[model samples]
Target: MKRRDFFKKGTTAALAAGVVPIIASSCATSKAIIDDRKKDKWYHLGTGKKAIPERKITKDFEVAVIGGGAAGICAAVASARNGSKTVLVQDRPVLGGNASSEMRVHLNGVNSIKGKAERETGIIEELLLHNRFENEQESYPVFDHVMYDFVIREPNLTLMMNTQAVEAIMDGNKIKSAKCWQATTETLFTIRASIFIDCSGDGLLGASAGAEYRTGREGKAEFNETYAPDEPDGWQMGATLLMSSKDMGRPMQYSPPSYAIKYTHEDAHPRRSFKWFQDGIWWIEVGSKGDIIADAEVNRHKLMGYLHGVWDYIKNSGNFPEAENLALDWVGSLPSRRESRRFIGDYIVSEKDMTEHKHFNDAVAYGGWSLDEHNPGGIENISEPPSYFHYHFKKIYEFPFRSLYSKNVSNLMFAGRNVSQTHIALSSSRIMATCALMGQAVGTAATICNKKGVLPRDVAKNYILELQEQLIRDDAFIPNRPANDANDLTKSASLIFCSTTTSGDAKNLLNGISRDIDGNINHWQSDGLNAEVQLEWETAVEISTVELKCDTNVKRNIMMRKDSKNDELYGNHVPIEMLKSLSVHGRVNGKWQDLGTIEANRTRLIKFNFKPSKVTAVKLKLKDTYGAKNIKLFEVRCYA
Candidate 1:
């Protein structure tokens, strides 16, 4: 018998013992099987074919990021922005991972209060800003090509699509290079880098390169999580393929293949299964309750069949009238796995860490999403009560940076759903928004490591303060704001400072005001003037330095007069120094005429003597040199 036939016949006994028959026998050709088994039996055979042609090695990079998902893209962008030569490797043609246009899963996170925006920064925020500009009137599924283009356009980033990292070339404890296989031309190539990031989600690099990792849940005592079961188990949350349907005037009929499994009322809460829609169609989710990696194909077929059956029920069973005209729109090609291999880093984030709201010396990321765990199997509907489901916790929590790097591996950093966390902790951090933050943190850390000529672990220990400052500068929210620590009395005061435009159309205040042709300083003098000012108070305290920030490039000075029983412009015009490219400062009383440079892309701070005796009411004169623009002032302080 032929090799393919021998394997097919070999599976007969397993089938006789109740294992599902292999569908590849009919669809897979001998040549395909031989090609797929070229490496090891551990590789997964799937629907996608790689498209990039392999090339010979000609360059080296500071950082290499595997998997073009949200985490990987952010990591690459952050590393590159920090002046590192970065390369991103992705197997798929586009970026965004599970939240990509191909997958179409809506991104979710902790919703900020009304009128308040979540503090998301770095590449993720830039992407959102791009989305905002591209789709001004409405929200759209962020196009995957846009994501790919964003990375490609960056001067320091090189994106390698249709490339799969097959093996890690290790030198002692560090990864020296990676061997990648391009499916399009059946070619292999090698990539050499100083640092490697495993954003592959499945911990593929870590596992292949002998990094320590965990696969299943730990006992409750291990993590001290109340939601965790008392005893440890081998069971893990499964993977799912999301599908949807569109209205087409009449319900489309679909029939399952002969080999497809059928569902019965006794199959555990089949009644809860129903159709809903988003983006373009009414939808339903179907998944594999067993091994995600092992049963990917089986789950794909079953999910398709389940989707069709759902439409069939709507059309023939008269259960859903609103969906009678629904037609199949799209089905996910890649399975979204909830749990798989997790790299064991220096610090494994446990449920106890989350519950206690542990503040780490090297905290890099935060997750507020609940601890949601799904059941292993035996039920088709995820909403079913006992086995397959989701659970939640009361509040949000923080995750440390040490959990992102491997304990055994020297220069490797892990991001996304594969970071070092227990099963319960993974549930909350698995969301794409949180994962993007993890990527940003790792990318920032990678840049610091490269600059300091150190490992990721070393960066975490020695340069953690620098890392935190960089993250804060990039707008990633650390628990406390640095400005809050500055000594400032008026920091607690809420005052409305106004600016008038000269010649530009002011549509949205957030968009900012222009100095030319819109209006003039006179336009801001009257109540209900063309320009308005609003101040929202955060906190107040005494401080010694004050900084001002503006949205546009301009030379401006803020002349301040104290608001006391007597108000006056104090002495000579306290010449606010044009400290940096965007900021201005001056001592409160000394040199009111001469200004100097401070810092670039940072708030400008000014210091001067304000002896509760010398001044009562101080007046400020506002002037512009580079033209009028909307400005923001912060970090105001008064020394005790």
Candidate 2:
């Protein structure tokens, strides 16, 4: 019998006999297995006094996130940080899905909107900043390790690589457990969680639980999306195969692989022309009209062939002499996907919602990338432009909380491209950092579900404001949304004044807007490096935490780009505007007490925690910045 058949039969027999399979070495002797199992282990009748180990394991979590891409990683981290024991399961060996080293796609968000990046913040910002600090060399493989470190180091979170959440064990409409297959260990993992978040780009876990998901394009009539196709179709956006080339000291000979498809770019669309040839061409992509996930393996092979074919043309066509010394450095085998099963939700974000900036009361996150819809047939359709940038937004748009969780699957939620949005809306929100914001929103919601013992819909109906408050408190910017945390003592302070101000007022920090956007001045910029912001109360107040949202120059992109573009919109290194040092002093017994000091800050949200003390006044002394002459701060909060 085949090994798969043997395992199937073995599992059935073990279940029927009510025997626990000992998970020892598969090569262990029967006596050793029996000694471990206490006569309760499974038996293979034909073997001499035999017992075989079962390569299976069971785990439990408050939340289980399927997919370790940008969305899933943010979800897992947010959940774990917000008091939920979380597990992040990924099918690949690495954490970043499309942005992983395997596929060197740029980790893009609102890269450039009206010539400035309204970059994503919160957990996603933390990860990107972590990369900037750690991977100064800018190696893609090192970035994979940076992400791995980011997830692995988090408490209350478990990172499972090479593990795919293949099936969902449902109890009524709620997912009770996720049946996952870990290929590397040859063991199956059953992860039971109160809430399940499927950030998997293909959304296999949510689908297995009978989620109400729709594949293919939605017609214009359905969501009233002007950018949508006139009629519904099965054409999803294509997955791209990326490759990079390095210039060798000596000239490198080039030849096409056997499977390479012949490319005659004589009549190719002008827009599809390569801008940066040394970096991989984004147009080398392929898509399927139906079942993109099922056709992944086949598409990957074709993408490989197409990638080499394009490189062959560049090196040997004699059209460009700049590539004489260029040799292939990295060739991506995995085709980073664009669209698949979009799980339905309470609200389907359509084109008008984004273009007209329709506001949702339950807004949890925001996105501002342009509506860039790629042509259907990708490289094969050379006559058509690679992408149709249908619309651009001057201001960011709000993403509703209702569009995150499943409409039918009570405990199931999703982020990334799989979240419920019309294809038109997805054209903008599908960016990795944009999806990461959704992940943080859903992940925080999962904790609320576990805490209240309620479903996702219930949270939207009753606790949405609370959810928004928490998201903002965590430094996630919801466009046009101002945080009103009642517990924040900063609001009760009698006076808040800066030592010196050049641009914005010290009062703006208390306005609860974390970023300067939509033509609003929300930050307080100091005239010089050595400045003090004092907050005084009428009487002594107990405080222990001082959270300040400093400037990381969100206007410029900090995420890693393949081309390493360092223009005004895209920054290659850390933002010089970041505050490098800060010291806090509290007035206790009429004496200035040294609370704490942060020498070198690396994040936008700088936090200082010390022993709780009753103080009449608190003063924050700001020191040097990373590079800027003046220091800018978006928010400041005081809490016990």
The sequence of per-residue lDDT tens digits that candidate 1 reaches over residues 1-640 is: 2111111101111112111112211122122211342333342348355433223443489999998887898899989989899999888777888767556654444321111223334466556445433443322243565676778989999988877665677899999887665555454557888999999887556666778877767878887777666777655665655666666776566565554344433433443444243222212333232344555555555555555554455555655667666666666655566677788888888877876777787877776666666544423443353222234434446678899999998999989888899888877788776788899899989999988999998988898878876775454655432423322344344443444543222222111111111122211221222233332234322222333322221121111111111122111121222222332232233323222233332222233443232211112233332222333222223334
lDDT of 2 at 63: 95
CA lDDT scores, all candidates in order: 0.56, 0.85
On the 0 to 100 scale, the lDDT of residue 121 in model 1 is 42
Q: What is the TM-score of each candidate against the true structure?
A: 0.68, 0.92
**Candidate 2 global TM-score:** 0.92
After superposition, the stretches of candidate 2 with alpha carbons farther than 4 Å from their true spots are 1-51
Residue-level error in angstroms, candidate 2, position 379: 0.8
lDDT of 2: 0.85
Q: Compared to the true structure, candidate 1 yields what TM-score?
A: 0.68
Task: Give lDDT for model 1.
Answer: 0.56
